[model samples]
Target: MDYNLMREFADSWGLVAMALFFVGAIAFALRPGSRKMADEAAQIPLEDGRS
Candidate 1:
């Protein structure tokens, strides 16, 4: 295996990949379905009378 090639590739593309992943995560988190799911999860205990 070539360590130099691996390091260069990682340095070049790793940041882009990480940035894209972060943006995607943020977008998904702000989506309506995500909020709805969160709201439903918050109501579970209330519905079950466990609160």
Candidate 2:
């Protein structure tokens, strides 16, 4: 619970955890067949109140 212990953990395992999360997110964003969903998501703001 001390500052040094927390800082050491953050400097080591925290960096690894963040790096893994970043790579996973990049992989998800670039996966196959995601373009259609991404395009649809991109248009959500332009759509009016109509369905």
Residue-level lDDT tens digits of model 1 in 1-51: 599989988898988899999999999889877888989898987785654
Q: Which candidate wins on lDDT? A: 2
Error of 2 at 16 (Å): 0.2
Candidate 1 at 2: error in angstroms? 0.7
| Candidate 2 residue lDDT tens string, 1-51 | 999999999999999999999999999999998999999999989989775
- List the lowest-lDDT window of 10 residues for candidate 2: 42-51
| TM-score (C-alpha, index-matched) for candidate 1 | 0.68
Superposition error at 31 for model 1 (Å) = 1.2
Model 2 regions lying over 4 Å from their true place? none
